[model samples]
Target: MGFFTDCSRALLTILSLTPASNRHFSQHPLALQDITIEPEKASPGFKCQYPSLKGWTNCNGPNSRDCWLKDSASAQPLFSQYDIHTDYESVFPQGIHREYWLNVTDKVISPDGYLKTEGKVVNGSYPGPLIEACWGDDITIHVTNYLKTNGSTIHWHGLRQLHTNEADGVNGVTQCPIAFGDTFDYKFKALQYGHSWYHSHYSLQYPDGVAGPLLIHGPSSANWDEDWTPILISDWSHRSAFQDFYVELGNSTSGVLGREPTMQSIVLNGTGSYTCDPSTDKNCLPQNKRKPIFSKVFQQGKRYLLRLINASTESAFVFTIDNHVLEVISTDLVPIHPFKTESIHIGIGQRYSVIVEAKPSAPVQKDGNYWIRTVVSDGCGTINQSKPEIGVIRYNAGSTALPTSTNHTGLSTLCADEPPENLVPVVPWPVDHQAVNDVLNDTFEAFVSNNVTHGALRWDLTDTPLWLNFSNPTILNLGNTTWNPEYAIIQESYDRGYVYIVITTQAIRKDPSKNTHSVAAHPIHLHGHDFVILAQSNQTYDVSATPKTFNFNNPPRRDVALLPAGNTGGYLAIGFKPDNPGVWLLHCHIAWHASSGLAMQILERQSEILPTIPSLDPTRKTCKGWDKWLAGHVLDQDDSGV
Candidate 1:
């Protein structure tokens, strides 16, 4: 039997063998904070407790916030047996099951006081509902695509789908898109914890609205009095992303060549105020009909854990609240030592879990309100009608007036990630020198070229721009002797060693005229594993000398990191163990660039991938449904099918 099938049978046996009394759900005693366990009706034996429960002092049980699983007396923490040094590739707790259902449909909505008829939403909300679970919990989500004319697939942003490649949910890589009126069940284990967002991987669907927050609760490196739900900040446009993509592609007759789409406004938690001109646009709502500014009520003297995520199409933001110093606790899903900063730069598709004490820099104001700013990073991307002050933080719950607070001075304006030294992982996993040498031997150059199809400009991470076939995905065509060159597959057959990938933007072309080098920084995201950033620099990489500059001792490890821009000859070197036997995607998280073909596939342990999948029956069924629906549709494959 396959790994998933064996897991299913084992789960059934465990559920059936446990006594009825022992299956009763109960919250742990340390659940005094704002975090609460909300089990679904289908999950009968679901039990969740704060990881730092007082009486549970054993090494096998959940450790305290300040304790590690292997060394309970130490200050470093690991969740139960899944601590920092634990080999999460093969070992993880088999926690309770959590089930959720999502319905995706086309709807007309007003997010920033401007109506967009081409909006694609999940469960009738612009920014979909939060999907929460504890670490190691088996999560089953049934996603139904009800869109009248589109195929969809939902990708859980940073979850490592260990041994379960089919659940990764990339449309053209893992599986086919869910056909209209069809429900696809995605089952996988929550191996990593912390907050991330789930969104449609079908073309440009996520930018229109098909997205939501996903929080996998677990132990933290620091303590907080209250935990807030994920705060999603994004650039909102009135027009559909599909229409905006035409401008991005320079395909629209009215659009200028190679121009990025200009967003209309900024939205925080699905609400914003747009300066709508009703005289020129009928879709603009009146002042009284618009939604109020996004705000959060803070209790005095209490520290709050704020999960910050940037879901923008192209813009990078500097997140800050007026007069509040953010004590950053984690980068993406990786726990880090606490560091204080006035503001943080958040790249698109990146997440940060920060602790902000209720104490403001100055004494409490008469209005007790402060502005939450999402400032556009300089040299990043642009928003036409940008509003830095998009939200508010109120000390008084009764206040409805806007904050008169001033902007935080000395905020960083550079379009770069936070300092690498400040993002030190709490639990260090040092890299091997030999592994770094092995990876540097095979370097991948990232560059923009104009020699692609029809001589169109495209960004490439490999030899060619990735253009995938919707009908025949990578998961179904594994173990093949050859692959389509357009698929951009990088094969790594070994299963025992670490895979280090060095991506540099300083690729020198034979014909100088064909080189379309870009100065824009890319937020690179890897699908299957959280890789360590060995070295990142704006200087040109020297294959011989650069190896000495790499930080082999516990570098910044995360799913996404900023690959510096090409103006100064940039490069990003990252390393991850080849433990997950799957065809994982490594791509730029920028919506325009990803759809413009800046991506590649890492086919790790290709020979062993087929044996892990118990059945392709469900995959075949979904593909058949997609093919049948596609036959009657008139949609065009304009860009990359990712």
Candidate 2:
């Protein structure tokens, strides 16, 4: 069968298998057993009753401002007999299809009142246009690269690309980069729901500006009066990331070690204020010519849902609003039990869905303006001209005054995630302890080494630092028995059982130079699955004792988590079922670290992948185009090629 034909067949099968009675939840609206079947839905199907503001019998539907479709108070399933506990890996609603077209090009832009000569953006905007969809919707995105010299690919951050590995979009691991002027169509099912981002996976591309917000609307654990667009908070650099990479790599000729690039300012949803002296810098815009301050209007007593994403090149932030309490609803793509906090520590590539009640502290100003702060976490990274108060929240819609509210006191500056105990998943997933011994026996040590990749300093999560060939991705060579060592492949053949992997910053290997020790936290992200955090600790991993500390009982589960920084010991242990049969990239979300080889590929059930994929013609065609473009071009592959 042809590729699209297979996808169509799968969708049809899903529709046919769904009991007609359950389509509208005609009976047993909250009963989980009523939806039982030999096999569950995995593909697109006929348009079913999606969550909407109108016509839902029991409660407000998914699109309602006051409540999410099947909220905690409704007692109704999220969609057609499915609730929070339903195994999302196997079942999803038969949602409609969503299509989008993005044109990537080079342009001169000023996101922070300073012009960037080498900016790359999608559809001519930084933090590109929002891509929204309903849960279980089949999405098709056509990305055409118009860069004068570079190839590009967009990775759907935090989306579990189940059964659709080809659409995962890691340039060298999934498919070759989309050659200049060539369009690559990415097709995948919305297996998981929540807000995330889509960014260029090609080296240094996303940092330049090729990224945008992606929202897959679904059920929520908390109710809100309004839903806001995703707030993308990032550390910005005046220079293009490509040029800054040279400083990060350092001068090998002079024996100077590479240093982390310093960011100039913080941008919230693509706008920030930078102090520039026009006398010294002609690229800096005058105060009158600069963009206005980023602000959001809030009504008194109304609760609002806010989606926050950290898309920084190398910084973690503490998100907060002065004088207002935050109710965190979800972490990453997983809905969690609501918890109240003064501030949230967010790592790179991490996302949070929080609800903020519009009640200000006593003696509210007549203008009622509050500051939205994205404070860079100390020790995690640094910014040259750091500004925590990058935005404003106004209770009065017409208020143009700056906030006079004082920041909440006692906010920690520690560079770490919210305590693991606080991030309780609403849907409990009890991890099996059978693999405890296996995980302890094969723990992956993450450390920095200067010996790898021609003496350039590199970070390694495995024995070897990852290096990729753009012309040869792992998907194209799935049938091979032994893979290239530089690919950093970890094979897992289990199709039904859970696979637990422990990653630590403590150096396990003996380094004669003693330069392998690094006290930097890494935001480790795994594609294709939302893994359970079995254990996260700042202490050294004791093989025999640490196993006892594992939280097998429904620990915090997400796509990304911070591996704490420590010179001697700090570790993050995660477990996931290897049910998906494809190659998935697991790497640090830090742009510089990833390019420096802190990455690896997981070949899960490789033997089962080729037989499922009907054709590689689409993959081959893009590679051919890339090869053709490269024949006449002289672009050097300097970084890890993503």
Candidate 3:
């Protein structure tokens, strides 16, 4: 595509050097305006409500029992949608089915050609819709929000919603928030496989675009050929990640420390180019009509399988591909042990399945078109983008020309993660207890505080800032044994093997008279366990020299990792094995630092998690349909009820 329209005027002359953002975001309380996007069709004779499952197919008829109408009307391409049987360990002996109806709404388009900004997407497309499944499958999806005033959910990110904690779609922690004409459905179980992504944990609605790409297939530490579809590397925002979470949480007259809203471009799957700035006046569209370009088509020496997703709501990418290299098999949803790299650091809500090897070597490259980069990681934010934010890789599918190659020179813009001994885990997993001498440990310390009472700027772990209770949900007050220690409870109770945890971004001080603590790095995430990463460090931790640099043997487990900030503090030490009971959510996958709270709340085995949830009547009928839309609407609930 003319090398993405000549890198879209060199990425809009580098987003015209930022400074003209905000084109009205945060709408959808039904003030609904403009609205004009169409083309998604395919509800034909729809109907397949679990009709004997297994790759479902029925299409109504024969005295239709109204099977909940959901025909994808002959659609395809999510890496062949799902028949994935490469047998790397193949074991879904049957009971595998999948479905999806999705829909959600709002869209104005212009994914990076600067400012069109309306996004919320899905079915109206935008980074949202590539589901696919197969490892112990049994997924379902449905969705439907039509967002006129926002109230949606969808979080399957790193699913291990084991006892299906209300299918773990957090928005007030599991249930409630699918209201704009509601339709929920989720159903879980692809049990631990390879790729991940499916966002919209409400509040700040996944960087104003919900989000997608969520493969499952099964095993792989090697072997490739063409498994490519799921590359999402976001950071875009002309405005409205719920108004950039009020410029990163600052209200009371914008005083209490809130300002991390810089980004205006760095998309990849949903294209990118953004940069209007005729000096300002925002509302751009001609750069050859928002120059989209996420082309792929590799096939030279063949080895492909690149699932890389870093669905950034707060960047931290680093993935590269110029003279291709990356072998790296699986990370989120574990299955590692296959190294080789040229780049592959991904963090905001991580996921990696890399295995490139398309062999593109050539001279001063002309048409083989490389430039896949992503770079951005000024410790996870601030992406001005002069270059290395690209996406093209086209080993001649009748090239459109561009890549002059080069750009792999001693990289280390210093943001960490992907070096827990190169993430080893081809399924070993043996860490028998001991997270810095675990006596059922549960320590934390992440900071960024301004005493957080009314001075606003909160992001804590200790001086409490969790604040979630949307119509009372701790899985509907799990038999309330009186608990709300700022919801930082870690109540485990068996599955005795590990549970440790000990995060620590050096105690406080974002300027406690300045001694250190403005460093960033914290892609923490952990819901339903994948934990183990005993000891990541920038050193300041010293309970006798950080428990002798703990790593109880086979460490490196996944579901997001990367604590490292530094000055003199950033230790991490995780350890999971509360073998999936429920009410999980260990957070920090920064969507403005987990809505300004940097979360916590394990509660596993909380009295055996509601008798191992098979159904709590669809979670109390979706919390009585979110308490009948919270008794005639009024839900803004500031941030972090996610």
Give the count of colliding residue pairs in each prediction: 0, 1, 8
Worst 10 residues of 2 by lDDT: 33-42
lDDT of 2 by residue, 1-642 (tens): 001223533564565333222332111122322211110111234222343213323233433322323323333234323445545565555455567899999999888999999999999999998887766666889999999889999999989876678889998899998898899988777767779999999998998999999987666777776778787999999898988887777776665668899989999999999998877999999888888999989888888888999999999999999888899989999989889999999999999999999998766766789899988998877798888999999877888898887788999978898998899988778688877236754577776665636557677777678889898889999979998888999988886667989888875443526446777888999998899998887788777798788898889999999988765689998899887788999999889989988899999989877754546778888899999999999977667777
lDDT of 3 by residue, 120-196 (tens): 78888787777776445467788878787777878888777666777788867677677777787877656456678
lDDT of 1 by residue, 91-205 (tens): 4444556789999999998999999999999999979988888765667899999998889999999988776788889989999999999989887777777899999999889
Query: Which candidate achieves the best lDDT against the true structure?
Result: 2
The worst-scoring run of ten residues by lDDT in candidate 3 lies at 33-42
Evaluate all candidate structures by whole-model CA lDDT and list the values in order: 0.79, 0.80, 0.67
Please give each candidate's TM-score: 0.88, 0.89, 0.31
Query: Candidate 3: TM-score?
Result: 0.31
Winner on lDDT (2 vs 3): 2
What C-alpha lDDT, on a 0 to 100 scale, does residue 160 get in candidate 2? 83
lDDT of 2: 0.80
Ranking by TM-score: 2, 1, 3
lDDT of 3 at 341: 76
